[model samples]
Structure formats: structure tokens, C-alpha cells
Target chain A: MSIPINSSKAIFPGLITREREPVNLEFAFPTLDGRITPAEQFYVRSHFPIPEIKAEEWRLSIEGEVEHPFILTFEELKQMPARTVMATLECAGNGRSKLVPKAKGLLWEQGAVGNAEWTGVPLHLLLEKAGLKAGVIEIILEGQDEGTISEEPKAPGTIVFAHSLPLDKALQEQVLIAFEMNGEPLTAIHGYPVRAIIPGWYGMASVKWLIKITATATRFHSYWQTLEYAYWKDLYGKPTLVPVTEMQVKAEIARPALQEVVAAGSIYRVTGAAWSGEQVVEQVEISTDDGQSWQPATLLEEPVRYAWQLWEFAWNVPPTPGAYQLRARATDAAGHSQPDTHEDMRRTYMVNFVAPVEVIVK
Target chain B: MSIPINSSKAIFPGLITREREPVNLEFAFPTLDGRITPAEQFYVRSHFPIPEIKAEEWRLSIEGEVEHPFILTFEELKQMPARTVMATLECAGNGRSKLVPKAKGLLWEQGAVGNAEWTGVPLHLLLEKAGLKAGVIEIILEGQDEGTISEEPKAPGTIVFAHSLPLDKALQEQVLIAFEMNGEPLTAIHGYPVRAIIPGWYGMASVKWLIKITATATRFHSYWQTLEYAYWKDLYGKPTLVPVTEMQVKAEIARPALQEVVAAGSIYRVTGAAWSGEQVVEQVEISTDDGQSWQPATLLEEPVRYAWQLWEFAWNVPPTPGAYQLRARATDAAGHSQPDTHEDMRRTYMVNFVAPVEVIVK
Candidate 1:
């Protein structure tokens, strides 16, 4: 059978249409403003039809390696505690269109990422309330979404969207069971009454449309974890397939868009956003003359823990008119910087390479 | 250093810029007319700068595994004999932009092909005059153009543009050593003085800028041959590296233009061209609904050996206003039709798969 692609026809104002059935959308990067992406412009990634979910009838179950297996109504969970954190959520396959070998996946451009303020109950509070038993290793989160994968690395049969996080990471203060986005109630398209917001990792790790959570005594290996989202990680020259976990340091140009034309000798504000996994972005460099030379761009604001850092460069365009290729690179506090080319340790995932935006200076 | 791309600043009425240093040009296929592409409209594939050669001072050397290792002046080569053949010349990587896994090479669209009437002397006549040795296995053709390779599978150092043909293939009467193109003396860019016209083979095999010919006893393995133009051919399931040869059976649509709009319920004449390797095209099929259904297109003229066969389809359009995808499929006398998808045998080359031309009826 011909492999299925993200042929979604869904569209939203100020957003780029990506896929339809599940309603995937992309932000119009060049039109972006400020740090937080508008709710209507935030990218939507769905694997199955939006479930007919209702907040009044919903319940969350905490079971398995726990002292007291229990259920909490949506109201009960929301009444516990409310905390908000600004974070960047990026699809692991964000820059899929640029992958070499034309790898299969959603042909997402540079808009598959966005920064948002999420408000929800701390996951640790619920876990502490349920009381963990001895030898708990990981927490498996399953969503209400279910569908058959029709692309490569397909499933054997019907499958549910699920992901597991190591218990140590799950106990962090920032992990949340989000029920609100940007201070507003989550929309039906954005996982409505419940979702897991996992900061510092790819969006796939944060299962949406949350239904149940299971504390396991051993490391969990879901099909999505081992097959599709996995990439070849080299260990001493040997390629090993490992699950893609974190978002590598990446910066993307948002102004003077690809192939945009500007008058010669004009002062243009070249601005963009940069983000990294676990570590905060510390520096961003811009190259106006392709990659011949580079200059540091000043950060618009101080770096945040889990949010994207915005940067800008004021260019003094030369009088001569010609085509100029612009590119940006970001480095995190941990010293991880975006690579010029995708190393062999990739297969349509973690494509945080530096992308060029060619503009015609006329 | 990064390898050069189609960085040419040259612009013509309708020709698409491909490469600058080599002055490679691509035809705007949708605006094409008639069987023979105009001289300026013909696709030009150059490996290096147009060599500086004067017809009064130029000479072609025929040597190696032959009794007469002599040279032929431009006037001598032209006075011997002249014949013209309307043949199709394709860049092997014509549909390179659509290759999956985002393979690297040229990101050519569907314009790197055209049919031209080549005028030249039959190569067999010159070989007979130079009496070949019994051990000769191949005829090596070299052009005067030279450059250093900086791309993947690059040459170890500076290399000349070269290719070789099998002994039997070289003896074919259709192969030509030509000094004229479209009834005019060859342009420096197309190949001045004399160049080999290799009918039925990919353009790379038809080396440009004629300089010398060597009849070799051993199979030739030039860098352009074994390293770049080679693809992985599967024997059973094991991949074996093989040299890319003749053009594959394929068809492409030209009319209605891509994304062109027309009045609803109008009678539309969809036209295009189809060609194959040695086997002549026998049939051309049209799909108006994106391959779900297909109808045979009327061949405008009988198929010709090594030349593109023009085909047209008249459709009574539906009254509804919507977008429609148009694609063409061609089959040769050998029953080889364009594959729906590129099998694993491809690696940025031999991208002769069926391509769609989407149009809108408003």
C-alpha cells in the first residue's frame, strides 16, 4: 500500500495548513511577534480524530506500582493546585522537509514549533497523593487518542498514543498535567480538559488527550518509543537505534523571510527565536553573507528556563543589490550548538541543523 | 569549499538558470511548443566553462587500440559526412527535486530535457578508418573542459569530463561526432567544433567539448562513471553498484501548466511528451483524477527511435470548480511503464517516475 502522509487540509488564520484529519497547523513564522505564539497560530499535531471528550464525565486513573490506585475527576484534579510555566513545544520532526535522502514524515517547514504559557496541576502532587510503591522506574502516560499508523515503521495493528518518562524526570517541579494554555481553557483541538506538558523534550514525549497513567517497576518500551521516533545514534562507530528524546539547540530566522526582497542600503531588523533542550540558550550568531563570516546578535530579553530566547541583528545592507543568504545558529548554556549538516545520527528526527533563508536584496 | 550550484546570473526569455560556471540552462517545459525545442530553448548541461576553441585551430584525436592514431582537423571532420536525427536528451536527474529521502545532487525540476535534431558524422565511419584492435572493449570520449570537484563523491584532484561506451554500442550508426546543432555550427557552451551525440543514453554519456577518443582494452572507470553517476542496483536483495546508462521509460505533462486556472466545464486539451530508451514508446496514459482513473492519450505522431513521442488528451471538464491533478504514464514496446514510485534502485539518479501536474478549474 502507498504510505500515508500528513495530507491534512486543516487551516487556521495566521497559520500554515499542514494536515487535515487530525488538524495539524503551522505558524506563519515571518508574521510572528513577541515571545509567545498566539493560540490560533500554535502548531497542532494530532495522530487521531479529536475524541468527543467532556470535562464533566472525564476521570484520570493513577495505578500500577503505587500504594493506592485511585481516580480523580477533572474538577478534583484542577482543584488541587494551579501552576503556570512558559515553555517551548517543538515536534521532533519540525524540520522534516529539509532531511537529506528525503526521509518520510510530515513535510513540516520551520513553523512546527511555538512558545506558550501552560497552566496546570503539578504532576508530582498527584503522584505524591497516589503514593508510589517500592522500585518504581518509569511513568507511562497514555492518551485517549487511538489510530492505526499508515506510514513506514507502521504498527502491527491498532495502537494508542502513549509515552513513558523516567521516574526521576517525572518527579520534576515543572512537569504538569496541563488543562489550560496561555491562561485560557485548552481548546478542543489542543487536547481540551487534559494533557501532559513535558518541558525540555520533544512534543511527542508529552502525550495529549490524557486518559490514564501507570507507574511501572521497569523501563517501559512502547512501539512509538522504539520504532518511529527513534534515530541511529553512533556508539564507537557502531550505529544504534535509540529513541529521540531532547530537542537540540536550534535557531530560525523569522524576518526578511526566505526569498523576501528588501531595498538596498536599508537597515533591516533580522530577528528570530532560539531554543534548546534542558539548557537555556545563551548565545545566537547571524551570518549575513551566507557563512563567510558571522556576528553575534543581541538577545531581546534575558533567557528563561524552558522558554525560547528571542534575538535580533540590525543589518547595514550594502549599496550593491544581489541575492544574499542568511542563516542563524544558537548555542545553549551547556555548549550544544546547531550543526551545519545533519550527522549520520539522524533519520527524519532531531533535525536541528542550521537552515538558510535566502533573501533578494534589490 | 562548498560545491557550486546553479548560481548562474544568466537570464533569457524563458530559460531557467541551473548552473553559472558551466552555464547550464533548463527549458520552461510548460510553455513548450512543437516537436523540436528551439535552439535557445534547449536544455544545456555543461560540466565546466565553455572552452575557448577556434574552428580554424581545433582538432580531434582518435587513438588507443587502433592502427591509425591520427588527428582530424575541424574542416576534415565536417567534409566527410553529415546526418541529422531528432533525439531526446535528458539529464538522468531530471525529476531530481521529487526524490524521496531528500537525496542530494541537482534539485532539477522537470525541465532538464528536450528533443533536438543533431547533425554529425557516424562514429563507426571514423572507427573503420582508424581500424580498431580486437581487444578493444570500450570507446572513451573526453572533452577539453576541466575543473576541480568539491562535492560528494568528488574527484581526488582536478578531473576532465569523460565517459565511455561499450564496443558494440560505439559501433551503432546513430552515434555521432557532430559540429552542428539545429542546422547551425555548435555553440561553445553546447560543444564547439565537434561533440559526440550519444542517442538513447543519458546526457552525461554524451560528453561535450570534443578533444580526444581512446579505444581501450580494459573497461574504463572514470570518477564521473564509478563514483557519481553510479547507483545501487539490487541483485535478488544484495545491492550491487552499477553504472547508469540509457534513459528510462517515462512521460511528463506540459499543457494546462501547473496550477493554471481555467473556466469550469471547458474543453481542455492536455498535451505532453513521452520517451524511452532503445525501445520506442507504444502508449501514453493520462490520469485526470490523480491516478484513481486513467484514459489513453492520442499519440500526435508515431513514436520515433530515441526521440520523445508527443501525446494529447481532450477532456470535457466537470462543471464543478475544484482542483485536479494531471499525470502521464508511458509504456515502451518492452512493456516498461513509469513506476508509481521510485524503487530502491535509485539514488538521486534515474528519477524517471511519473510526476503530477496539478491544475485548478475556477
Candidate 2:
């Protein structure tokens, strides 16, 4: 049996629908412990099939644009200088299903996000050993997991799996060729044995089950990574689309989901999580009357970077009957604020918008 | 064998760490389908022992300042107006260990967060059934999880595990007495059969494995909920501490952790998450150079209160040979911003200041 998550004390269990939606959500809650969302209580999002990889058979191949093309088994990779980091991983479609006009796909309700510790070797070290070649403008990656969505060769925009990074990024030390997660080897569903840790990029760019690598001056496109998942929209009424990449600033209330009831005169805790693609979250504020006024909530003791941070606030309810609209806002270290909507983006690559929740005061 | 989450293509043998460290990171690569971190790929944080909850024998009792005090089994609770919702839950200490000067306790390196669809009875239904009595200023909850940690209870401050909800919040329709998570019955580690789904509070206030409810005019205190886990600091040179309750705005790069490598001259998808505790996320900005000119990232979809919203940006790398410091920032709907340091919190609820990643270039 899968280990259980401690969620009974969860604050925002059901603010949208009464059933847990298999997607993304804006979570809010009250907290006493300074822990960010406990690992077990964190959200989850799965795409494709949850692959199961064996460590013994897992081998990392560094072949493209390198002086030495070699395949190193998991054991060999582990023997190399192992680097550890604490980071968060999010899905490109984390909150995609919640878009207005409802895009064609699963109507996910916000369960596709999570944070964890990932351990592995930096890709630069491996690349240095391989000896990067000149003119390697693009680095293409291919994974072992393949599938046929239909009987036909699906459009490159539909089924093939691949992605690329610039030679500069490929050589950067931050680009890790990882094999472990959260102080342990990667779990099957996560990229176990060997996977690329490409910080500052969307999940699409980090190819799992890596089996092949090629360096090219031109771009390498894959059905899943490039065309299908790319974000397209009308820019100033002009049809334009771009590939999904960096993250945007956003937040949600996980505790007081819509329609939650609290006894009159009782004090309740409020809390939730926040993050940005490349920025550090500066502050999180709260308001009870639909953004009428705000107060800064307490933040957890996590270092902010390219990952999620947990936050919380305590709301004192007045003994009165009324309707309350709750909202949370975030700002980053560079002075960026979350937007009310994604209307300004030429393409819907990221959706960093302010979300609100309605609660009834009986 | 423990299902390895790091393997990209398969699920098999791996080890599980009992305690997670703050700086220990494992890299994760996305699968063919664009999901880098799936449900199983996420981390788990268990505050107390995993509760041994049996759905068949489980019971949720609503007592306190109510006209009717009764205990309802899981089945009975489900018989009430059932509600379901998708929300994220985060531990307050999600990134506590990341704080500089090294705070005491678990050194989690992210991965203490998750989203889920929860289904269950609303706490309002139970409150309505009980008919809350006047003068009940707070609703205190006690979970079945019990343990005694060997630590000296400091004067005026000690950690405990009890939370209070004000009366107005108790009547909110969103408050739930949950029984299911993500369409499945509650897992044992999660509150099984019956648990409190209080949105907008930290996971601790949700009170997993709930067993009792009491009404009081004064605040209820517990070691886990108060002294031990919450934040502490000096007020004007005087030792002053603040209990962590509310959330703050925060963000981080989810995909490419620090020191990751990427090919040069290729477009990479940069993604991250952001959220606020007071208002909705208004906007997220990205900067390749730390704190340099910022560009807005794409914000995806509507978010519930207290939940982190997903965002992304696309970066077409420039052929360069220098390191790049990836940076991100966020603003809330009501015009709040994240901070640059946890020290800015003044009271030190463990909220770290925002910072940018230093990605070494080739």
C-alpha cells in the first residue's frame, strides 16, 4: 500500500469541487508547525505512464558533441562527485486545465506540483569528461520510454519525446546529470538512475529515461516537448505561440477551500505555498474582504530560489454572519508582483494570476 | 523494494531516507509527457508517526460548544453533504533547514509539498448539526497521533499540537470533514476515514488522525503546534518568538537546480511556482541576470486561495561563455511583494529571504 499523507488536518481539501481533482489547485491553509507542505501532504501530477526504471540497468549516455562518447551505469555515475540540492519540480500544465474556455485536455484541479531533494552528478562534470565539441549549438536528448498514441506516426507535435538545450546551458555547472532524489535514488515515477536536472526550465526540457544525446547547430524538436505542449495564443489579436518554459509567480489557499464551515467565534489557521520560476518570493499578503485590505502572513524557514516556499497566516473571525472572499498575493525579490490574469502574455507560457476564494460566515 | 522515484523509465528497488537534509538535492528529469514531478515523484513529510487509521473502524467526533455532541463513523460522515476539492498542502518547515545559521530540526531540501483532490463531509454540516453554542471563541482539535519527544519545555514557549478555529471560519461552507483524497479513501498516513479539511492553514492545523474537538475561550496549546516548530526571534534585543501560522509570498526554480548544465544556443523551458498568503498572485517576473531587468513570465490559469500557481517562461539562450544568475520575483493581486531575506521577517517565523540562483556558464 502506498504510504498515506497526513491531510485530515488539511485546510483546503474541497474549495472547488467535493472530489479531489487530479490536477493543479490554489491551496491555502493555517499552520502551527513551520514545515512547508509536508512531503506526504504535497500535491501530485502524473503525465504519460508512471515509468518504472531499474537502477542496475540504468545507464547514462553522454554521446552528443563530446570528445568521448561513453555510457556510464548508475553505479559509475554514483562514483563520480555526487552533488545534492533542494529543489521543487512543477508541471507545465499544472494549472492549465483551469484556463477559461477550458483547453482540450484533462480538467486538472491542481495536484501536479511538488518539492523534493534531488541528489546527483552535475552534467558539466560529465560533459567535461566527454569533452564538448565546438559548434554544438543544440543538445538533443532522447529517452527510452516510447509510446504510440495512435496507430500512425503521431505528429512531432503529438507524440515523440525529446528536448534540447543550448551548448552554453549544457556546459553550465547548474545543469546536472542527476541520479538521486531527496537523499535517495530516484523513484521509478520520478526520473531514477539518470535524468537531466535543468534548473530554470520547465519540466519539458528535463528529459527522463535519457538514452541518447546529439549535438547539432539546428534545433531538435520532439512531439511532446516542442509542438504539442508549446503555448500558443493571440498576441494583440495576432495568432502566436511559443514553447512553454520558465515559470511565473503565483499562489493559492489550500486550507479554506470554498464553502468550508467554521463554528462562530472559533479561530482557524490559514496557510498555503508559493513560488516563481527564477525569482525569489519576497512576501505573501492576505485579505479577507476580497482584496480590500491585506496583511503579511508568516513565511516558512525555507531558502527561496527556483522552488516553492510554504506560507501561512492566522485569521481571526468576528462573531458575525457574512460572506468573505479570501485572496493571497506574492512579490519576488526583484520587485515583481503576481498578475491578476495572464491577459498580457503574448503566449500562455506561464499563468501567474491572483486567485480568490469565497467563504461564508454563518 | 521501495519504488525508486529517480529512475526515469522504471520503478523498482531504492532506499528511503528516514530524515531529509536541507541541502541534499537529487535532480529530476521530465518524462516524455512533460511531467517532471508526478504524484509518486514528490516527497513526503510526516510530522508525527504515520497514523494507523482503519477506515472501517474510524470515527470522526464533533464535540465542543455545540448543542449536539456526537461521533460519526466514516460511512456516516460520508452520508452528509459530501464535498470534494483540489488543493495543495505544504508543511511550514518545508524549507526550514534552508535558513542560514542552520536552525534545529529536519533539514528538508524542499519536497515537503503536494496537491490533491479531497472528498468528504463539510465541517459546516457537522457544526450545523451540533449547533455551536455562544461564547465559544475557539475550536480546538486534537488528533489521534500522540508521541513524546525528549526535549526540555522552554519557559513561556514549548511545541505542542493543537489548533483553534474562530467561529466565523467554522461556518464557512468550504471547511470539510474529509474522508477521501484524490478519489481514493484516505490513506493511513493521511487522516483515514475522517479528518479536518481546513483550508488556508498549515498542515499541522488540519489535525490529521483527528480524535477530539473542544470549545474554549482561551487558546489551546501543544508542543508540536506551538513552541517547538513555530518561529522564534529577538524583539528589540529581547528574546521574542512568533508562532508560525500564516503564509507569505514565495517562489523558486523547479526544474534546473543550481549548477545544472544545458547545451548552448538552444531554447530551454524555464518553469517555477509562486504564491501569496494574503491575496492572489498578480505577476511573476524573470531575469537572466540576478536582479537585472525583469520580463514577465506566463501565468497559467485560475488558482484557489493558499495554493501555489504554476508559471513558466521560454529562454532562447545567447551564445555566451559566462555564468548566468537566474532570478524571479512575484507580486500579489493586492500589491504585495516577496522579501529578499528571511531576516526581513523581523520576527523570524522561518521565512527565508528570496535570492537568485547562480548558474555557471561555459
Report the C-alpha lDDT of model 2 over B1-362, residue by residue, as the tens digit.
Answer: 21122222322222224355211222221221122233343345455566677777776667766788898776676677897865555556666655766655565544455556677777777777877787776676667754444432221122224456666765667667777777776666566656676765555567667766665554343344334444433322212223465555666565445665655676666666776653567788888866767888877646666566777777666678667778777888777777666652232243535666666555
Fnat, 2 decimals, each candidate: 0.00, 0.00
True-vs-predicted CA distance for residue B350, candidate 2, Å: 4.7
Candidate 1, residue B258: Cα displacement in angstroms equals: 1.3
Clashing pairs in 1: A8-A19, A8-A20, A9-A20, A101-B101, A101-B102, A102-B101, A102-B102, A103-B101, B6-B18, B8-B20
DockQ of 1: 0.01
> Could you tell me the lDDT of residue A95 within candidate 2?
59
Worst 10 residues of 1 chain B by lDDT: B1-10
- Kindly give the stretch of ten consecutive residues in candidate 1 chain A with the minimal lDDT sum: A1-10
TM-scores vs. true structure, each candidate: 0.50, 0.45
RMSD value for candidate 1: 20.1
